[model samples]
Target: MITFDQVTVRYEDTAEPVLRGVDLTVEEGELCLVVGHTGVGKSTLLGAVNGLVPHFTGGTLYGRVVVDGRDTADHPPRELADVVGVVGQDPLDGFVTDTVEEELAYSMEQLAVPPATMRKRVEETLDLLGLADLRHRALHELSGGQQQRVAIGSVLTAHPRVLVLDEPTSALDPTAAEEVLAAVTRLVHDLGVTVLLAEHRLERVVQYADRVIHLPGDGRVVSGTPAEVFRSSSIAPPIVELGRAVGWSPLPLSIRDARRAAAPLRAALSAAVPPPVRPVPGGDRPELLTARGVTVAYQGVPAVREVDLTLHGGEVTALMGRNGSGKSSLLWALQGSGPRKAGTVAVSSDGPKSKDPRKLSAAQARQLVGLVPQTPTDLLYLESVAQELDQADTESGVAADGVRARTILDRLAPGIPDTTHPRDLSEGQKLALVLAVQLTAAPRVLLLDEPTRGLDYRAKSELVRIVDGLAAEGRAVVISTHDVEFVARAADRVVVMAEGDVVADGPTTEVIVASPVFAPQTAKILSPLPYLTVAQVAATLPADETDPDS
Candidate 1:
């Protein structure tokens, strides 16, 4: 369905090729999962299939890219509309119509499908993608996940034989992501359409892929079965951890398969599993930063009504909820970025918000609450990766005191080149760079909106470590994310919001394990235990703690 032979793509401004000498092919009906560290050219590889690399991107192409039979170099994206359909990471950026049904029908109309057939196709796609209920809804009214589903539906209306997605699930919640992937899997199985998707959340998608393509940061595509590729990669899912431990030849791809392999190993390794890590012993436990009797309204609608909550000084607290449930609103109020009434948000010293704060500066609002926006890269303007970090350090007062920019860069995203332009990197890499900038503030109460949205498994873990480190350093970190796994792993406590009110708040263990909505993979596997990390589960093995003589 697609082919790339010795294809190299170089943008006009950059000397180095984004995609280099890529010889790749996607067979008809095959679901190829593209995995890579950020900035490794995963998106560029997908762009080749749809002619976006040299067309819209205006990059110099070295070799041939053939889609279904047409050479992509000779054919632009518009000409291949009937052959290829693309669903990108940002659904809003790709939307063309105001309503869901119209959006789905727009592409088919452009393809000049017969009206009767287009209507049927659109209806079927709406049902298939689970958008039938939302067909009449406005595009802006839908949640991010719903908007993505609409995007997929719109693309599928073209009846393209091949589907190319660039991180389709990056913005979606776990359940919504599962729905979208399931829909894609059904397309491959039922319609015989081929799929080439670049994804960050491998733990959810790896199990369903027929082939996995690992694109190293240094520019190489290593292809194998899902288990084979992940087993050898630096990044892998939780099931892969179990595979490594028990010596499974072909690593298990999914949790179900891992559980099957673990049944016997459970008894064998019971003595080796250790206990969970307790929080660090005595230290200065900081006071709670409280928002007292907060009330907020948007367009005259009461979004948050007299809500009171407290975020502690040195702990990571997460705010989670469904779409339109006021998670973003609460964060905005906390940051003073949104309008509120009758509330007192007390910070360090009750001082005015600072212009910049490494931690807990009430003097400056903008710098005191360092926020990594949902669209991470939208906030970046620096020319190079190095410059971005330097600017961030300067703004946050860390430059004078000196936090090595490269150290933070390498820690959060090691594979990214400091000399490379930020705009040229993949969306995931850009997000990582923005995160590095936000961390430069070293803000006492850091607020991140969907920090791990587009990050891959490896990048996600890096973020987890970073968040944990911040909390350990006595900084309060508050994140608004849809990833239950992330909340479980990084957050010491959870604050769930619904309809602008706090629904649940407690220790991470209690909130995640107790709620039916937020069961992370590790929690599910070690259900009775509620372990969030591999180390936590490994600690359960008796042999890890018992005497060898015993």
Candidate 2:
């Protein structure tokens, strides 16, 4: 249904093409997954399907891209809207209507569909994507994950033959992500729709992919079955990596397959002990921040109820929950910057009395508690990376001539050019920049909301290192995220929230291993085991025994 014939895309003032000699074909009723590192032209490849590359993005296309018998070059996005529907990374950017119901119906109205058909399709899509409960909610009021579902439903209502999704499940929680992926799979199998999806979170979608298209960052494309591609691919899901580590022939792509081949490994690990969880510091860990009766509401509707929490020095806590479950609201309220209808947030110190951060100035609040929100770019305003670092130093009153911020940035994501614009940086790099800005303040408590939204495995590993180092320095850190795999690796303690209240709080292994919805893939495969990550499992086995193929 979609064909790219020797396509070479190059922008002005760039010597190298983003995509070079990319000849590929995606058959109808197939779910094609595009995989690669950050900034490797995955978006460029997806944009070519509907003529967004050369037509709207101001690039030059060397060859032709045909979608459903219509050449994208001859038909711009508007003319091909009937055949192709695209959903981008940020859902809010594409929203034109105020409410979920209206956004879903807007596409059909633009395409001149009858009102009755549009209404019927809207209902079907709402049910398909599990948005029936939120049909009347305003777009801005919904959580990020909810907004993403609405964005996808808006495109799905059009009933296009080919669907292009970029990071469709990046913002969704575990169960919600499953629902959306299940709906997309149904479109491919039950309705014969062609889907071309690009996602950085391979663990969530690799098992459902019919084919894998890998961009190696060298302007080259490699296409094959999942097993064939992952056999030599540098980037792979944990399930695939586990299979490789255990020398399982025909590397498993799904958790079920991995479990079937892991009996021996599980038997071997039955008597072995997993690594111990991070120990609480002795002698009563110092209290860094304390909150009491925290409440956040919007337009008479409470998003976060009265909740009391405490942060301790040298501890890393993970805030986790489903979409619209008050995770973000709680973080914002705790940070003292977001609205708090009724709460008192105080930072501890050697002084006789604790300091209420909300009563202090912005600069003073940041010195006690710093927050890196979901969209890290919101914290950035300067034109270049160097200027941003300098501004951070000035704002934070760091007299080290911006050395502290630059040092943090280098440690988080090394080798970022000083002249590069903050907007031009990749998702991971932008996050690192924002993190550096926040850390420069040397807040006793650091809060990160959805930090792993767009990061690949390498970037996430680096982030884990940074978080660990902060904890080692006797600073308290909290990461709010839905990526269970990430939480399994990075978090010391897990706190689950739901419906404006704290539902569960405990050690990471105890909380996640018991919940079916929150467990990582490795934990699922090796049931009755306490392992949370592939690295943990690998650590328990001998080097020679782990990899028979080696």
Candidate 3:
């Protein structure tokens, strides 16, 4: 349904094209997955399908992009709206209506769809995406994951022949992501809709992909079956990596297949012990921050309710839960920037007495607890990366022009151009920049919400290293995220919240291994084993075993 003939895209004042000589065909009724590293033009490729690349983004297109017999070059996005529906990374950016039901119907209304037909389609989409319960919820009041589902439902209601989604499940929890992906698969299988999706979380969607399109950063496109592409591709999920490590005959894409192939490996590792779990720091380690009776409400509705928590130095905590579970609200409350109807957030500083952060000035609060919110771009408004770093240094009271901020950024993610606009950077790069800005304050406690939203495995590894380094330096870090695999790797402790309350809090392995919803792919596949990551499994493998690929 979608064809790109020698497509090459370049922007003004750029030395190289973002996409070069990209020729690929996405067959009708197929679920095509676009895979690549950060800043690898995955978005540019998706945007081309709906004519958003050269038409709205001001980029030059060298060749033609045809979608459902309509050339995107000739038809603008408005003209192709009937055939192509696009959902972006940020759902709120595309929302025009206040409530979920209204947003889903807005697209059909724009197309002059009949009121009866629109109502029917809206109901169907609500049920398809499991959004019936949230049909009346206001858009702003919903959590990030809920907003994402609404965004997808809005596009799905249009009933376009071709659907293009960019990180559709990035903001969703495990269950929500599964529901959305299941819905998309149904569209491809039951309704014969062509889907072109780009996602950084390969583990969640790779199994559902009919075909894979690999984009190497060098502007070359490689297209093949999942096994063919992952056989040699550097970017892959843990299942694929585990298959490669164990020399499995065929690389398993799903947890079921991996588990079936893991019987012998499981038997071999039965007697071997997994690595020691990181000890949850006790009273020996100083408590850096404490919160009591924390309550956050919006318009008489409570989001976080009377929660008590503690953070200790030299530890990393993973805050996890389902959508609308008050994870973000609790993070904001802890940072002292978000609302707390009734709570006391105390930070232990040089003095023995703990000081309430909400009572402290903005500067004082930042110095005590720094926060990098879910939308890291919200903290950035500068024209260039250099300026953002400089401003962060100035605001954080760092004497050097760009020393502190730039140093932190370099340690987190190296090779980001100083002259590039902050908005133009990849999602992972933007996150690193924001993290650098927050770290320049050198707070004893650090909080990151949904930090792995757009990061690939490589970028996530870099982040894990950065978090480990921070904790080693005697700083407490709390990462609020839905990426279970990330939590398995980076967190020393796991805190699971439900309905604005902390339900489970313990060491990382204890908290996640028992829960089906939050367990990582590795843990799920190697059931009965305590392994949480591919590296952990690979560590216990006999040294004599050889990988077939090698």
* Best candidate (score: TM-score): 3
Off by over 4 Å in 3: 277-283, 398-403, 410-414, 546-550
Candidate ranking (TM-score, best to worst): 3, 2, 1
Query: For candidate 2, what is the lDDT?
Result: 0.88
TM-score: the better of candidates 1 and 3: 3
Query: Which candidate has the highest lDDT of all?
Result: 3
Worst 10 residues of 1 by lDDT: 354-363
| lDDT tens per residue, model 3, 483-506 | 999999999999999999999999
- Model 1 clashes, total count: 25
- Each candidate structure's TM-score, on Cα atoms with residue i matched to residue i, is 0.88, 0.95, 0.96
Q: List candidate 2 segments past 4 Å from native.
A: 13-15, 277-284, 349-351, 397-420, 424-429, 548-550
Worst 10 residues of 2 by lDDT: 276-285
Models, CA RMSD each = 4.1, 2.0, 1.8
The Cα RMSD in angstroms, rounded to one decimal, for candidate 3 relative to the true structure is 1.8
